[model samples]
Target chain A: MTYTFHWEVPLQNLPLFLWGALATLEISGIAVLLGLLIATCGALARLSKHRLLRGAATVYVEVIRNTPFLVQLFYVYFGLVVVGINLEAFSVAILTLTINCGAYCTEIIRAGIQSIHRGQTEAGLSLGMTQWQVFRYVILMPTLRVVWPPLASQFIATMLGSSVVSQISAEELTYAGMFLESRTFRTFEIFFAIAILYFVMARLFSFLFSLTGQKVFREAWGQL
Target chain B: MRRHGRSWGWIAVLGIVLALAWTASASAAESTLDQVLKRGKLLVGIGLGAPPFGMYDADKKPTGYDVDLAKLIAEELKVEIEWVDTTSVNRIPYLLTNKVDLVIATFGNTPERAKQVAFTKPYSSWNLVLLGWKKDRNIKSYKDLKGKTVAVTRGTTQDIAITKLAPEAKIVRYEDDPVAMLAFEQKKADVMPTAEVLALKKVKENKDMEIKGLVSRSWAAIGVRRGDPDWLQWLNTFMDWHGGQGKFAELFEKWNGVQMPVALPRW
Candidate 1:
């Protein structure tokens, strides 16, 4: 069987696609950052002095982690308007991904937090460090070193997961591919290009994350 | 005294048992009749968000024309109907991976698609309609869309037709029709090419958009994995029976005002 094939950049679509890929990167990046903040808070809550805070964080983690991301995305995009709270699809994409990634980030970070020896914390206390100082320079900083690799991996997963936002028509990489394939009727070719783009984006993210890790943890990189 | 040989004998027996089980499972998978009977439910993969086809009603019940057709198929097989909602991208995967027993989604049969799957006889027709601003007479047809941006959902007949007709018209593809609708509402695109029913429905809701012309004829059929002649014959008989009994006309009147065109062969 002969296949009528025309595979090219479809010049007119390039700028829009470039703009879309940048937006995807922005959404995923901001989400991972905000998600880190949420994870820190959530992980702290899991270790909080207050029972209610711990319960609340546990429930939030369980619910967000268990449900389908697509369902959560729709709930976020449509549920807002249903409650007289409206935001554009881009904002919803960021917000939904932050919540989605934060749940797992909380668990990963919690493990790091728990791994900090009672002896190191005691040493900080003996050195006349304030509770907040001990939590920061001693506990949090060291936990970060322990958790940074897994965190970078989650950030990668978040980038891939953000592709779900295209369902609400949030014009990311996958969304752009959908548009392109539909136009060209080159589903195989267009989707093939998109798969490569995703693979490249994933690799690029890992490379950058490694560079950032080197900058953030110079001593750790030296040991490596 | 012979412990090593005894262990080896047991391992050889385990291997033979596993091989027999694997063959049994392979043969069992193809007996779809037994599957349907055993399950007592026919699981169909469909997109429940699309209107006039597979869609959810206000009550959250799956109740579009395709939903009814899926129900009919289940009833014919003497099984209860279970609907699984999937997106356009996941539909083919759902069928190929055996996630669902069948699919009644509004699958547009294309030469490429025919390679991966078999299609039952066409049960419904879905043609493309050009929707423009209600008052725009200047952009009536493909000839007029030159240098204009037209928005359409990805993986649809409208997308193919627009590109085929007006290569000069810059096509902006959206993942869903609603996004294209928003683009049309915002005047980002000169027109939105979509299935006729959707165009008419969107035009009605907006009351400010108008459908210009029917662009191309298409047959939307229930899709199954390729090399299923047994399944295909069964589905064809079912479709032909229902199509002749005027179920489609009833479905059309039921699903708003998109009538089944008389020119299209029903059975």
Candidate 2:
């Protein structure tokens, strides 16, 4: 069997792929930021004294964490359309990724918060710090330092999972690759290029997180 | 942490094992037509999101020529129609694996494909035409498409035809007709390979586009399992009876807004 490798098909669409990569980054980046915000609120709610607040947070985390991301994406995109709530594919993708990532990040951040010694809270309170002030000035920064690596890893996972958005025909990296592959019938070449691109993107996310961690957590880590 | 990772590893292994077992069980079923008849439903596979052939109308109901034809066949068989939405690529797999009794998708009949599945007589045919901006005088012939980018739906006859006709041209495949049309309209592609009817619709809808060149005429037929001679004969007979009553032409005009050919070719 003779095999001819045509790398030209995918390469010709490099501009389109790059645009798709940019979109992937934009979605994941926005989702990560939004997830972080939602996670903080969720973690806080889970720690609340009100039973209803804690229960609601627990349900959100458990439901999202247990269900597949693909299912969640379909429900948001297709199910919403059924109810006359039509959302653009890109918006739906960002919304779903943010919600899904928020659940995982909530648990991770909550764990970090719980890991801190009780004396730290006492230390801040005795210094005339309000509850919110203690969280912002003392507890929050340290908790982030403890959870940054795992949270960053989850962000990377979210970046990779963004590929699932193509199911709803979102113009992301995988969608671009699929479009090229279908036209050229060069499935291997297209997929190989996509695989390498995804790998580089994942590594890029990791590298950025590492640099941020060093800058933000240098004191909290306490040493080299 | 080590134990958690190890447990995940075990779960992955178990998942793969279960998936293989499930696939094996899924494929080794009995005769598809028998299954369909026994179930009292003609499990017909139809393509979704392909306009003028199979697509959802404004009412959000599946409508088009392929769907109408499938409904007729199911009515003749004295069974309820269960429309299983399929893609251009998965139609054959859906039939061979007993997922559907008949694939009435826009399935082009080709010799390479004949090895895998049985096809009935042609229900419809359309020329694969190149479409480009009307003002683009540079793209009048096949030679002009040497290095141009062309948009086509993935795994469709137009995609295959374009690949063979212009190996040098960059072809971008979309998931469906509407997406490919969007790519064309967005000027992401220099041209698009689509059915003649679809190309004409594009020209009528957008004053900028017109047919550039003809690739090849492709005939679409109902696909069935390879070993089912009885099923194939029944489908052919159904097509002939339906065609004689002029229902095919009625559907042709209803969807295409033009008269079909005097007779669709018989093989």
| Pairs clashing within candidate 2 | none
* Native-referenced Cα lDDT, model 2: 0.81
True contacts kept of 2: 0.11
Model 1 local distance difference test score: 0.77
Docking class of 2: incorrect
Q: Which segments of model 2 are wrong by more than 4 Å?
A: A1-143, A165-220, B1-16, B56-60, B89-93, B112-116, B240-254, B259-263
The superposed Cα distance between candidate 2 and the true structure at residue A193, in angstroms, equals 16
Per-residue lDDT of model 1, residues A1-224, tens digit only = 12223446444466756666788899998999899999999999998989999999999999999999999997887666656776656788899999999998999999999998889889989999999988887788779888988988998999999988887667688777766654344554555556556666877898898887778777643532
**Residue A23 Cα positional deviation in candidate 2, in Å, after optimal superposition:** 13
lDDT of 2 at B192: 86
DockQ for all models: 0.17, 0.12
Model 1 ranges with Cα > 4 A deviation: A1-158, A168-172, A176-206, A212-224, B1-34, B135-137, B146-149, B168-190, B254-258
- For model 1 the TM-score comes to 0.62
